[model samples]
Target: MGVKEGSVLPDKNQQESYIDKQFLAAPVKSAVDKFQLIPEFLKVRGLVKQHLDSFNYFVRTEIKKIVRANDLIISRVDQSIYLRYKDVWIGEPSVIMDGVTEKLSPHKCRLSDITYAAPIYVNIEYITGSHVQKTLVAKNNVIIGRMPIMLRSCCCALYGKDEAELARLGECPLDPGGYFVIKGTEKVILIQEQLSKNRIIIDTDKKGCIQASVMSSTEATKSKTVIRMEKEKIYLYLNQFTPKVPIMAVMKAMGMESDQEVVQMVGRDPRYGALLLPSIEECASQNVYTQHQALEFLEKKVKKSPYFSSPLEKEGRALGILRDVFIANIPVRQNNFRAKCIYVAVMLRRMMEAILNKDAMDDKVEDYCNIPKNLYGPQ
Candidate 1:
């Protein structure tokens, strides 16, 4: 007889539940007893599983933070699911449900909840040799000036991906100014911003000068307070003074016969004037007669100029031209070439001294005569 149209089909859910119950009940018939298994399986394994679970949760949370505020669309193909975040697509293990396929629509999905906004500002600073002045202010989204502000010692405020690692190792040199609002920390951010804005303003001034008003503070009756903001021209004065060279050395180097001549020569040369006088005064402190002896010895040393084969030959060739001029009795301009000749004579003396002193040669005349006669005059 044919089945009736209203007859009910066997329940698939009941069959699956029966199979599962049978499998569980039949599991006690194993050849190996449960008590005979390794004890670590119950303790260490359980702890390991728990630790793995915690680690997995941490990783998932961190990944979620990275992908938050971003939509993820996924598609299943074979053994893998192709996941897409914005324009990026990735593949991972996944399962398919029944014969149905679900696709994420770009327009319907919402972004993850992870996102942050950061505000950037400009910092301005005026720096001299010994002092630093700083200011910080907001910046608009436009280039109002063409000139860039001068930063004495400036660098970016942001620490990139490696900053944390570097900090952990105590290798990071970043100034944690704006990141914290503590007493000294607050100033870093404020100063950086101020310097940035000041540069922009300076660029806009057309004269390359910062004309912005800076806030100043003054001591009051009970407390310190901001008095007023005033605009001032920034000035940085560098120390240009240098200590002078010793008088004995100057006399020796110049082949000067007297201290007066050394002073005159130094005064004539601005380079020498800045260094020679002080050095001479210091050297004079050793002994009065020794100072004079040093000068005379230096002068004698200066008279014996050394002649190198290469440079001396070249100089000799040039001097040959001058010697010809002198031989021709041509009135060469003395003042223009006199100082140059004197410098050459001094250098020659120093060169000779360097070589002879190294060899422990006491006789200056003997060594002086050994130099090429063509380059140096007859001994």
Candidate 2:
């Protein structure tokens, strides 16, 4: 039979559209054999593939029920597939393929998609410096995230200069010793097992401010916990482990009298002498004697002199005089001891000068000894 004119050959436009759709849907695979066209075609095709896959997955998994109601039309354009479910049209178009699936709308369809992951947590412990406490608290605003936080309170009263802020917080006007807690939304995760492995001992007096860290508890078993009280803050630390002999007994053992005169001479302020006097008397009751030895004990008192400024220099001069006048010659009488006291007197005089002329005195000792008043005296 002769072929009829205008016989319906497959619609060339439709065929071309199908092929184009296929290329757009899976550009990488579709262009694999077409080396020359692959580079340009696959570039865009690959970009749209992820979104297209996601859309396809969503359609199959989430929108399948809606599709059965005739509310959706799944169409193949060239090589690409598209869905139009009622007013919403989602697909990878042939001309634009950048891994982005479009939801066609009358005005504009934007894929405002978001994905979420799990959250993380961390813990930290640190000592607190009062000066830095407020600043550390202020840092909470900047470091965002749900994390439990804690910090030790500052141990000193003079932490920050702002007394008003400290007072507002009702923190001890003197010093507040405690820990600050910052609870987050989630429960705090503590590594208790790790913490348990290590041991820390804090020794404090009755007041509870930590004084020391001891290796073992027995070292300080008998001593009462010493707690230092400053203002209202109480600091607890381990007491001296074993009360050896009292300070006076120790002085007596070193061949010195722990008497009031000796104690006062040694820098123990007479104001506290009453409390320490009995300790000295007890040492005298032990018969550790010799006037020179007594003088030697008194020398210890002078050694601790309270020439507040330049104390070391004053101490050195006093010792030099003691050694030259009394200690150098044994069996020295009380009068000779008094004569040697002149060196201590001179040292005291110089110490007073150093305190007064601290602003002007140069490194030279002579400069410290020379008095401008004496030079200009009775002129």
Candidate 3:
């Protein structure tokens, strides 16, 4: 075909139009023209701000929660002999020299090849006498242990110090401190990312069976609870239990005796009920038809402890383990397992969904945008 005169010739205006349309350009401004916020952000929250915040939270709040979880210690031999922790606090860093206690600084710890740590003190009330003549003794500022101090944290001596003050203490004034001095060695804890806690994660196991898991974390306990299908039956795997326990049996032990109630709790969908039927039948096959029978069945399955040997004690210990360790993120108050049973049912529902829809199953290795990554300080 013969080319048009303007298209073949490519006039000056057409050439300009072609350039403008094919290659677009915009005015470029220097970074100085765009207000710099990074410097200001650095000044407000330094590079190590996350580490410092985590350490401060650990010291001021987490430590108290940890202490409160194990506040009372009762002797096994003599129940009357017990110790109650009233309060706990971290003391200022100090060292004893020639029987004289002197304040310790991070610089001194580095030079002396010592750890920069503070003493953890607790107030305690205890019974120190016979059961018939028990005497309650209260103690104050009892030293329990030493905790390494994270520099620049709220509990650190240099937390709010100015440049001149930091220089006076032989520290780098420009240092963004979020590390520990351990035996004269500077230790920096890098942030680590892991699967979320107390959230249901549905994935397939090595055996190609759909599973739902939770990394349950509480003040007193941290455990992994998983419910997976095996040969058409659901099973629970927890550290405190034996190899595995039937999911329905676990529910029944948690006061969910009726299989119909368990199915309903999971969902009204027929697909969910179908997936749970095998587990329910498995529980029945084991003769676990009631809460007491379920507990008795689990009593033998729980890891045996030397502390609980008697029949009654064993039964109670088994129930206690289930209540305290199984899906521990859900609180079991006053021996109530209603919430825990519901949580298990939800896990089951998720697993059933994964089975029904392959896309519903979360990949073992997931995208960063789909997961939460949290930075934590040293324990």
Q: Flag clash pairs in model 3.
A: none
Model 2: weakest 10-residue lDDT segment is: 370-379
lDDT of 2: 0.31
Task: Write the residue-wise lDDT of candidate 1 on 1-379 in tens digits.
Answer: 8878999866988778667676556655454665555474755554233333332343334333334423333322211233333211111111123964232211111131211111112122221232243332322332212211111111111223256754563334343211211211211121111121101011113442222211211111111111111122111111110122233443332234455555464345454433344445554563423434544333232222244234433333323322222112222353233453343234323322333244432232344332222201001
TM-scores, in order shown?
0.14, 0.16, 0.87
What is candidate 2's lDDT per residue for 188-286, written digit by digit as tens? Answer: 222211111011222233653322221221211112222222332222222221222233433332234335444444344443444345545554664
User: Candidate 1 at residue 206, lDDT?
Assistant: 43
Q: How do the candidates rank by lDDT, highest first?
A: 3, 2, 1
Best by lDDT: 3
Best-matching candidate per TM-score: 3
RMSD to true structure for each model, in Å: 36.2, 37.5, 10.9
lDDT of 2 at 361: 26
Score residue 62 of candidate 3 by CA lDDT. Answer: 86
TM-score of 2: 0.16
* Preferred candidate (TM-score higher): 1 or 3: 3
CA lDDT of each candidate? 0.29, 0.31, 0.84
